[model samples]
Target: MDSNGVDEQEMKLVQGAAGYVLEDVPHLSDYILDLPTYPNPLQSNPAYSVVRQYFVDEDDTVPQKIVVHKDSPRGTHFRRAGPRQKVYFKPADVRACIVTCGGLCPGLNTVIREIVCGLHYMYGVTEVLGVNCGFSGFYSKNTVTLTPKDVSDIHKRGGTMLGTSRGGHDTSKIVDNIQDREINQVYIIGGDGTQKGASAIYKEIRRRGLKVAVAGIPKTIDNDIPVIDKSFGFDTAVEEAQRAINAAHVEATSVENGIGLVKLMGRYSGFIAMYATLASRDVDCCLIPESPFYLEGKGGLYEFIAKRLRENGHMVIVVAEGAGQDLVAESIEQQDASGNKLLKDVGLWMSLKIKEHFAKQRKMDITLKYIGTFCPLPNFNSSYLRFLKYECDWVHVSDPTYMIRAIPANASDNVYSTLLAQSAVHGAMAGYTGFISGLVNGRHTYIPFNRITEKQNKVVITDRMWARMLSSTNQPSFMNPPNGATEGAN
Candidate 1:
């Protein structure tokens, strides 16, 4: 039986507006799920039931599905399976594989470690393989044998012990490798693109009449995977961003007419910049990809910065990398390895505009310093901003992108990643494939990959969280503000 409690042959795929084309995926039957009644050694203890959910059968009159969000028409249905339940595969015969993909996240190694440990400690599955690089590891013979002891110290380190890469989402070749290794279960650690690849691998496994299980551990530093309350490594990213913001704050306050500009990582969302700005409470301006702001109008960012400088003498600005891409002179159709659109250096562009506007004004005693590797801060001589030139005291710009991403998991992420990894392994052992382990509504549950990647998780400007962030930073709202404030509440 599957999550919907339907027979395997009766299952059919159903497409939704969100683009998930799967429904009623079959779970392993009792015959194939040949295992002992007690897979968990601690199942007999009453205290152990705290972490488990026994089979639930609700009243027939009640609705079985729940509306996910008010903005979406679709809802999520319930699924069965908990800690005490018997796992589908027998431990001794199971040969599992783990693969990490996409960019570096703080909790990659932690997830890998926990999964290896759980498979070994909980199920007695001794044989495990780590696929080096991304899906390409599945294409070639790049694999390493993994044991609990081998990954005992990996959680303390950053990056994956198995290594990772992008753009190797070849499903057929990956399936071929799985068969070659006789892998019965595959755990994938990655973001949306990588999970999409996992989905393809699962479908291919099914098409080949193989009972292999494929599970995903949600991994977007951006925290944009939909339906999950929060993705692992997001809290760590936000925490690390505060250090950069603090550096900018220190630089800005240290000089007489200094402006500190910090750029953060948010491709299509503003959660990182917003949360960092809120947590740091030192930013005069916060910009994100989801919101666009003018550089020089009456209610524009230029006047806002000038006002702040005249009042506070120094100001700090936090901008997400994807913010203000629309303002660039040319369209940026180029994408990165993970299918994300490459954004122009909005922080650099805005800094140049501020320098030009203040210099042209002449009466305003202001200097702008921009520092970052994306564009030359001091030497950026764009033809577009060549009409006016002015000298500013200094613009301190720094990108903590790589530095922040390569660090070990923070305290919060350590717990979250371990739970996600444990849930992923348990799901696979329970014959749940084509799913991503996530914390939905505070519960550790298996979310179908199709549902997980159905939509991009962008910050809702109308949400109270955005409102609180704006309130904390005292920044002008790019979107309409509450209580009937002006168009761009300043």
Candidate 2:
């Protein structure tokens, strides 16, 4: 106390008997303590680690600028919140299970192995079960309990060892089973369809007061899952595509007189084809489902190949399997072995077109090699199994014991899959459910839980602008047109 019954100084420091000092200050510019001296541990919480890592710079400063080119209008609807609510789940109390649904992808085993290992080893979770045949496996008696030892050798295997089914599980029944088994956490690994099922299961479980946490692991060769940057098998699929393209290149180069047409798999999107084209520079042209090519059009694939043969001596064309050649065949009124009008095979048709164009216009001799059997090994069954059943007269086994089992683990997908599995487990332990762990821009990240809202999922592309951008023909618009149209113009 001062003589005037008030502290004279703007800041007052009181010392205690144990050498502890309390500093009291109000609007004192000179004596104000900096934020560095008073750190908030919540700011560094690991749950928001992924978000912070992306938004914060190397110097721990938040970036001032963020550029979002696409979905700007939809993005504007989102309002930034002050801080994320902390939700925690007891690691021991959480009983988790993983189920792989749909067809097998390259990294399914990798993800399965990681989930099993991460739960048991890192989080001290031992009651992790592997549901076989996806949703069906949950209700059926075929549910397999997984241990760390069971998953130890499965990193490199191509398919899910726990098995998968398309869409057989009754959501209510599955919830009942989960409750009966006392499963508190369920990790569903598959595509959008599977996620929809997972969401249903989540709703059912929550409704029943089981307190089960349901999360999804995005697994699809299509790479169409929203919010996630890239799924696990996408890289493997691209790698396989590159290998096929490189092999095709070798064959084309060795023949010296032939053009190789290789077809890739992608139904609605050209992500795989585009990524493969970027990976395998040897691919001369890439045709995707997003891009439709016409035989009569100027700079069409046929004309492009013909020009390539006339100019570069040989060419390799990569076509998406879904890019129907029916348009071209319909234009020409061609029919096939079934007495039904047949669309030309993309590879064979393009090859024939190239040959016919060269032979008619110029007296150039050209050989065509249509390499269409380049199926990736792991996904080959899923890609062609139905065809094999009908075309090859293969009998369907009613109780196919071997087909019901999961794939052996592969070495390539094991590491990343395990890392992702652990990340998901960590997130779950920290009260993050209904979110998937994703690797984006070459870094491990969590797809925000809120981003998977019903509105986001229900959002559809009414306009074809984004779809057109994915097309091969439209992509060239980004580059300045050549002065003379590259000599292939009609």
Candidate 3:
């Protein structure tokens, strides 16, 4: 205590601390009351009066600011949503735009409908435009004005009405288009690359002293976006993948000692393959990019498949495209339009190797039937197996790639996509920018776009989920042993 019986540090203001200057934040009473109101009776609900809190910190001392610096030992850097009841722009004056980029996922149309409906019915924003062909539409003058009525039935559809593409990372052009249209908010729907572009666009808007709010809905069939618990369409993808696995199972069992090798769509992570295998429980062996597998060792995949075939007379293998990239002789570093690495045809390689192994070893006169390649390999059939019930050898390969990605969202995904779109619209209207609406631990939340694009959400091999998958398939756990050893050794 000081000599005057008071501490001097208590009187001085602590800037950027938790709960500092929160009273200075503008309130709904200051501006929202002056703006025009909507005719919707949903606004009369008692819950409308209760504003939802954004920051998880219960400390009342934190300030209400767009960005806060947390240099203290106990504080964390966080982005918080503004008061739900108030928004930065007036409803009638706001011009909102929606765009979809990156590859297609199941619930893209559903999200578009939800955003348009939310803006029209809840917020009374009448002017909404849709940008076509991804970010290129901004510069290319390809936009269509949208309405709630126009998007009413979009949720029942599959792909995005706005259409989508991969590249077009020019932030300046996008901002120029936004400013020309006097856009107040932007909703970007796609995966990590799309959100990263959104972040850049928002930064450019801020640099130009504009008040446009940018929001994103996380979309990736691969489910590889960082920090998100789940992405839209993943459930539907898994469900569709089950059908493909069943087909492979039927094909494998139809012939004697047949092996079914099914390749699912997953470039970086094996979430789709892993989840599909888990859901179906029909795959005898599941390989993902996260878990590498050897081909010729005693405990490797070759022996594993042979053992499964010997015991059950039929075997099914589920492999993500990215699982055995390292096994290929050449580099598969080429990326597609969305910057995804072109997989080195691990499925084809595995099928050929399995056939070669069985042929060279001649352990048994097994026939292999490979399907789903762009073209069948050059007339590589065996004479001994020609007279069998099936003309081919031990295995059949199929890739359920586009079939899964193009389907509509399932019941769970529809709910998830609706809430995600609603949350995205709420964030955009509340003046929250540079964030993606994401499900964090099953809670509807907005995560920073930069963080979402920071890293990929890969399956942790040490987690219990991996253990469950291993137990389900009974595949070899460690593909690469300790030390500097490589995979695919005899």
Candidate 4:
């Protein structure tokens, strides 16, 4: 029952020169027999009275790739996200519930708040419930009613007010809870694994012939979710990451031969590390999961570090958590509640290896300090420890791992969070089931759950962004020609 395979409703593929281009997501009407429709309450709302053409046409779709040649087909296009003139449920009959699963990220509270407010103010629908602790909350009897007053200023906070957890996903129990509670609209928020769970729930609900609308707002601090311009909180993560990079830069430049190493969160893709390093432009070397590098060689990371230090007398290195995992000896592999593979401490491993390389060189004494972060351990120093391990006595560091995600969403992310939440609510109200509220090429659209979960969006090492990062840091490509983008995610 995995959504990894395409269903007939999702076979809206267009044949172009590239061939087999997925163009649209599944609709509830495709599976549910004789679904009812009602006029959208927004048509009578005074808030939209001043607006022209507030409703998006069903035929409207956003292209996945905009920079294509004239002769090329439109390529992939997703159903645009917005309120429809016709909705599936009346305000009185709609009883909606929201659940947040997986890890914490900035703007979670904002999405929750906006969903409550959007349903209340825009559609005149009340009675929103917050599912206590993720998918398990459904059967655990963990529930709380949500109102505009309840989530009044939650947008100014970090993490989720509804609470979240990894794993604990039982499809039957969850859908049964939905059935028992008579919840017609279920809003599930989380990353890829959580989306997969959402997809499963949607399939089960459809199989049971329920009139539920399952809408997902893709949540990942990594920005690894595909079919979207970027995930929510990514801007805030990159912006907040500047603090640590600045700290590392100042620390590295303060003393002679001082090396400041920073470890960032990126389990499968190095988007965070790559974007942070690119924004700072203060890093001497950047390492990520997308581009693998060996420790010792004529043109290896060790030689690059030695040359950079010799040229500048001080340097800062940024490494993603999943970067160089193969290089770490006996790195224990594990999985979390959501089935995400646990990553070894690449920050610690890299720091020690770099120190050892310098030690064996016997050329110059280096003052190196570091920090790292882990996903499960949200405590203050857990992420810092990723940069500096216990094996080295020279570990001095700063931890912004939790600090970044725990802070209130900045202006940019706050706005983005509002759009994503409202879009999900609109889609659910419009009867779009098993779809994710995501951005495709800057336009908001409803993407199929399977389209986003099948593969993670990784950093393309051969692309211009990687080249720009290399140009910014003056770091070597690390590979003779670098590896393909499919060398696994991030």
Candidate 5:
């Protein structure tokens, strides 16, 4: 404590800039002394000559938190990502390689394309290699030279043009290969675990006194990687889920006392499930990893389903794959190659539970009957087939094998991936190492690798965004008793 007991630490002032701290990224100059710089190609390129603001000032930064109080310190900031006036590596000296690790995401191809194009078009760098099948490819010699023409139409396709894998990170071998191939700039695209691997590679490179610049393009369809606003391909995953949600809605409404149960990919964070449920107004209940839900108790999912179905003819239930793990009985513990927990099929379990509960209770006597619209076919006799009334007390909708992460990036994700890729390319060219190209508070910035991979970001069940989603779905938070509304539910 200071003498005055003013608690100056609460102010959290930065050096020379009161209350503002720059979370600066590592540069080659930080480790390698007297690193020479070359003029940025954009300075003389006719394509960018007419643009007024072609270069980003070194002093420019973006705040991590935008909703701070008036009296609060400005909090932390990161260097804004873009082209700089001078770059550490010359065009002819740049030997870059791109690798995608972990699982497949929507915009992997888009990111690969932009990174190659950004280097080829923005700078005159010629040598770019695609490390196939992830980190293992580093030693496996599964590489192909990448050019703008090679990735020209790959963006229009689904999945990565360069294949990806999980848990092949051999730091010694990878760095050895990098040194062997004279690769100076490395672009790694992956999720939290993958970024951790990227961090390891960077540390090894730094330890060996190598001049390679390692840049990370964070990739997680789950949106669990912290510090970034949102990862690329998350939008496309959520959008692709709309089709499944719509299909469930149709099936549920079609059957008597129907319960369309859908499961989405969310092993840790519930962003995909939450947003999909919110977008799907048909959902009557949302279950996620962040929100603990019961099934057999007073405030259980069964009670909510009974109530919702009683009020409405049918109900749709959206659950993240990681939800209800505590309730599901799994005797064996398993982990994937990337060390992520293997989640059981919560959607199937939920469907079975709902069916058993309803069948045992025998409380519902649904005789759903609907008439099809009569229409006259061109050059054919008018005919209409009416759906017969069915008496199924309970039904379910499930297709757990359909995964959304492998699909092509939607328009929103494509643009976001392009920006992220360009930002990574820029940071690499500018000599930033051991950093992630991510969006913080809507502004793209360079984040240290450890800051991104140290922990996973999760959904805040108590936050207002969750409340908004709850309000949209009209679903119970599954937090309160059946006789009362959920506590603190918005």
Candidate 6:
């Protein structure tokens, strides 16, 4: 006999004699009739009850024919996903070129090296060329192809190994040369002026329907390239300035007699001067291009230094190379041999004014010390002076009189340069045309092609808010006073 409740696959029964049949039973949801009706065993106990049924039928069985619905969570209609695919270039097919124009920065070589290696090894790019003398090299057929081995040892080098030129780009000739040599791409490395040239070249290339890609790499110590965090060489320059200021501080302290005037490089922006002062913490007064001063004003640097000399006996001043000294010296302007007003050196002028004021008011002969040239590299015809021998009565310091044009760049700067180089390679491989590889938020990013337009090349000046913050009287409590004295104390 077979029980009708049993599934067909499991139906089976065994029968036995004597007019009685024993049948195999299927599992049932409830067996209440099998339990004692009154006073059922374990029913009185609250913990256990054989009469109570907890199991129920669930419709979870596998279907005979599975149907995958598109809207279900496990649907098969979702789009395929994978890692991002990068565009690559064949080594033989890529004929890339780079040019460096204008003043040299500390990390120009590092950017060049990374670009060359990234192209050749990672992107299968070959025929990397170096354009000598900037845009001029691109106009003629004098470009030099750089091999993987050419840039192997340039990781720690300072300036661009390919050389640099100030010549402007000749677009028609450049396009002609690119077409003639079958160059696929070009990278221009430089500051504002170089970017302007790059824009022209890109426009010309686009006009002719050339298949060449163009990219720019920002390399300026000024750190003035807008829309980017910072330029490559700025860190190295700031480090150099900090070291110089530290040395000046030590010399200034030991002598206890003379004022040292250190002039820093910042034709427009005072970022270098401000950062260097923050690093050294020994700068007494800093004159930046953003802030102009009058010699006889209430909060003038001259007056502040005079007051300091009367009390502290010596001072240290940091002046940007581009600060307006003419306005400061308007009261007593003098001319040189060529009939040009021999504008007093801001350092010397301030030093002289302080000395005169102290001698007249306090009746003391205060010694004056002037130490200029805050740039890492030597400037043209600038004489060096020893701190103890030339400026002070003490004589234990090193002979700072010798000029040093080249110094080892900072480690931080080298790291930044490497990043910038890698970024340039990435940008070029991605077919990013007419963009500069820049470092921002600690990552390598691009400054778009349009930001370097001719009209946007001007440097931004410090607004009233910045001027107030940097002002001696209105400075924040955390900022050290210009006299190297703590605020709210004496």
Measured by TM-score, the strongest candidate is 4
Model 2 stretches astray by more than 4 angstroms:
1-91, 325-364, 374-415, 440-490
Error of 6 at 383 (Å): 19
In the range 291-376, model 4's lDDT, one tens digit per residue, is 98765666777778888889999999998888877666553467888777877666766666677768878997787767544222
The sequence of per-residue lDDT tens digits that candidate 2 reaches over residues 243-268 is: 55665676677655567666665544
lDDT string for model 3 (1-490, tens) is 4242122211223345443332121112221235433333224445455745432332222211223356524232223332254456678888999999988889989899988987887777899999999999999989999998899888787888888898987889889989998988899998888887887786666556576777888899999987667899999999989988888888888878888878888888999999999998888988899887677566777778788889889888888878877776564257778677766767666776777678788886554544354433223345423422243343323347767888788889998888898878776766666667777555566565656777999999999999999999887796565443345412
Q: lDDT, candidate 3, residue 15?
A: 43
Q: Which number leads on lDDT?
A: 4
Model 1 score (lDDT) = 0.74
Off by over 4 Å in 1: 1-26, 30-75, 377-398, 480-490
Lowest lDDT sum, 10 consecutive residues, model 2, at 56-65
For candidate 4, what's the RMSD?
4.9
lDDT (10s digit) by residue, model 6, range 114-149: 788767665557778898877788775666778779
Return whichever of 4 and 6 wins on TM-score: 4
Residues 1-490, model 5: lDDT tens digits: 4342222212323344558787777777766889899999989888899999978899888998898887888778888999998999999999999999988889999999999999999998999999999999999989999999999989888889889889988999999999999999999999989988988898778777789999999999999999989999888888888877787788778867766767788888899988887777777778889988767667677777788788888987788878878776444677889998877666644554565567678888433211111221122222211111122222332342245787789999999999999999899989888889999989889888777877889999889989998888776677754543222101
Q: Which one wins by lDDT: 2 or 6?
A: 6
Off by over 4 Å in 5: 1-14, 365-402, 480-490
TM-score list, all predictions:
0.84, 0.65, 0.81, 0.91, 0.89, 0.66
Reference-based lDDT, residue 451, model 4? 89
What CA RMSD would you report for each candidate? 6.1, 15.3, 8.5, 4.9, 9.4, 25.9
Q: What is the C-alpha lDDT of each candidate?
A: 0.74, 0.54, 0.73, 0.82, 0.80, 0.56
Return the candidate ranking by lDDT, descending.
4, 5, 1, 3, 6, 2
Which 10-residue span in candidate 5 carries the lowest summed lDDT? 368-377
